[model samples]
Target: MMTRAYIFLNGVGEKEEFYKKLDFKNSSVYCADGGYRQCLKAGAIPKEVWGDFDSVSDSEFKDLEDSDIILRKFSKEKDSTDGELLIEYVSSKNYDEIYVLCGLGGRLDHELTNINLLFKYKNINIKTEKELLFSVDRKYTFINKKNKIISFVPFSDEVRNMNLKGFKYPLNDYLLKRGDSRCMSNIVCSDEATVDFNTGRLLCILND
Candidate 1:
């Protein structure tokens, strides 16, 4: 059995409803600051609530005073953001994979930051209502993604010797440079589409 971890970020109320459909039964769940309220609203309790508590309301803090959930508080003046710190902690636990929920559709900076984290943590992925974001360095295959829309962006200066098999727009030993949109909005043509690259990282986005 592959171990999994879920981290919830602070998102708008509209996103709270999406949480209800998530299956967290066998996964470790954690919240970053204000995300605790959203997690609770979804009828799910996190194992720990981590952050500086700047975004959490006083009333909310009071509610957690006697709760069994662990609180990992840090200084507001810390160099790293709450999300980054929480991710580091989760990555250290040696889980097979980590899914970050509600990480998108928030502040633009935070959204980009979450995407950037993909390069640092090989097993971390950003999951939103409409998209799944992950990073691939060597080879990756998409199963049951036939005809689904997907895109690949070069996360480094340039992606070398990239090859795409079973896609609408196929690439053969192509070099994808940064800021390139040539590979955007491609459709998977087979049941299993493959992405291979010799060097550099590629950010893969599966749009729903």
Candidate 2:
């Protein structure tokens, strides 16, 4: 199945690169409020625009009104953040997989909240200018690329009975907990790697 790409105009760095790699024709595009500007800058067309319209400029809003895209506005004092609202919109459409762009590296609070908020959705990952990442709450297997550094962080206080295979520092029935630096940087040594944990969640990140 195909998935849509969600763009957030949070003014993250290296925006041009994100647009260069985006496939506009194959995926549905949704802009988070002011994200429409980034979408325009990236030379992408938007299918939908959503937000409180606070960050979106009057000129931009006027421009969008002249277009065929659907605009969904919310209150500034809404319970969920704009990012969360974007997710809610797409979720209602039954879009299972979404690639989020420019959701990192702007305001520290917004950056972190965007990342944490998406941890529960499967096949949904935030694609920052630097790297692509997703949260894992279960066993996961990855193809090993020699010398490629893959990082894993305990999403909770501790992860018990963690096992790793086909890695430089493979773990077996190990306990990986918070504040433990041992699992910070690990490289794949073989053709594949496996990670399984009994409890807690994992925030796995790979170098882009």
Top lDDT hit: 1
Off by over 4 Å in 1: 12-17
**TM-score winner among the candidates?**
1
Error of 2 at 37 (Å): 1.7
Give the range where candidate 1 is weakest over 10 consecutive residues by summed lDDT. Answer: 11-20
Candidate 2 TM-score versus the reference: 0.91
- The true-versus-predicted C-alpha distance at residue 108 of model 2, in Å, is 0.6
Query: Model 1 clash pairs?
Result: none
Per-residue lDDT tens digits for candidate 2, residues 55-83, read: 88898899888888998888899888777
- For every candidate in turn, the CA RMSD to the true structure comes to 1.5, 1.9
